[model samples]
Target: MNTYFITGIGTDVGKTVVAAIVTEAMQADYWKPVQAGELQHTDTHSVEELISNSKSVMHEHSYALRTPMSPHAAAAIDGVHIDLEMIEEPETENHLVIEGAGGLLVPLNEQETILDLIKNNYKVIVVSRHYLGSINHTLLTLSELRSRGLEVSGIIFNGKAHPTTEHIIKKMGHVEEIGRIDEEAVIDKQVIKKYAEMFKPRLEAL
Candidate 1:
């Protein structure tokens, strides 16, 4: 079974939305290892709401901190230390979509970062949204994954398209283009379904 690790160039880059679309497309199981905040409406809940697939299973989080801050800081505030060994991936036979918190280098604890959660076998999908320094962020993220000898399945561009930026990233990053999730007015199940269909071909090819 394929395991896709959904990460972003930065926070609010729409990793959860992309995870939902991928999960809907493959009817895969969903998991968010470390959730720093929004426990009431967690990423698992959000993905569950966005996806229409009945086969998808939303797994519980390892660490659900209270503050909407970095995992390390949030865990500190919650009076709990995020343990890497304790954050185990759920055993499943189906394809799994794992969403990470913040960026690739976001600290989970004093020693480990979000990147440490990614296994070598997992297909990493970097969700890149266009911004002032997004190009740099994208390259750095891809580079870091490559440095770790991780398998980067591809990149998913979120929000509006910036042709120049996209071109440079595709050429320089030397990564496959999985496609983009266009900006939407209302990103309901219908929207997620549409993107799922649009990205299914590429995702399957991965």
Candidate 2:
């Protein structure tokens, strides 16, 4: 079974949307691992709403903190300690999609970051949104993953494309452009399904 770790350059980069699309595309089991905020409308809930496939299973989060902050900070505010040992990956026969919080270096605890949860065999998928200095952020994100000897499957560009910025990122980052999620006013299941169909081929090719 293939495991895909969905991460982003930073927060609000559409990691959850891309994760839902990938899960719908592959009909894979979905796991968020760690959720910091939006407990009433968590990433798991969002993905569950977007998914149309009946085969996909939504695995519970290892840690669901209440405060809308970094996992470590959120845990602290909640009077809880984030422990890496306690965050065990769920076993599944189908493909698994794991979503990370914030970015690669987002701390889960004093000793470990979100990157620690990624195992050697997991394929990393990065979600990048174009903005001022995004090229730098995107490059740095890819560089960090590669430096840690992680296998980055490719990148999913979110929102409108910036030709020059994307050009430089693709050329320098040395990562395939899995697909882009165009700016959508309303991203319903139909919209997600549309992108899922569009991204299915490339994701399967991975």
Candidate 3:
């Protein structure tokens, strides 16, 4: 089965939203190895709801940490360990879309980052916002993936704050802005559908 690991340049950059859109487009199962900052109103379940028929499986430390902090620090405060092996391979027939807890280099353990857990198993998709400094973050993320010999399917520009962000990304070469979400609120089915449709050709090319 084809597998993809969805990561972002930083937190709150819409990784989950991008993952949901991709899952809808590809009809893939979704997995979140470690989820933090689950409030009473917003959680991973909400993300799963957006992707039609996409099965979601969480790790043992899924709900253990509640703070909106980095996984390593959140786990540390909760006295729990974020074990990479705890994230089991799912049994679904669809492709697996694993969403990382935070950014590329966020620590899963003291010595290991989330990138380490996902590098060899899945093609990476770096999600970035279209705000200031996005170019630097996206380039750095792309460089890191290349340095590790990891295949990057493409970059998704979430929350396009500028008019020329997509053009800039495409000009860089080897990276396509597969999708963009312009809404300033929680993404809904229509939004997901819009992006899924926009991403179809790009996804097929991948």
Q: Where in model 2 is the C-alpha error above 4 Å?
A: none
User: Each candidate's lDDT (Cα)?
Assistant: 0.94, 0.94, 0.74
lDDT of 3 by residue, 1-206 (tens): 67878889887788888888877777777777677677553435666667654354432324347777888898888888887677566667777777887778988779888788675767678888876788788887888887888888888877745657667766773686666677657578777877888886787677
Candidate 3: the clashing residue pairs are none
* Per-prediction TM-score to the true structure, in the order listed: 0.99, 0.98, 0.86
How are the candidates ranked when ordered by TM-score, highest leading? Answer: 1, 2, 3
Candidate 2 scores a C-alpha RMSD against the true structure in Å of: 0.7
- Candidate 3, overall lDDT? 0.74
User: Candidate 1, which segments miss by more than 4 Å at Cα?
Assistant: none
Q: Give the Å error, residue 37, model 1.
A: 1.2
Error of 1 at 81 (Å): 0.6
- On the 0 to 100 scale, the lDDT of residue 123 in model 3 is 65
Per residue, candidate 2 scores C-alpha lDDT tens digits across 39-158 of 999999999999899999999999999999999999999999998889999999999999999999999989899989988899899999988889999999999998899888999999
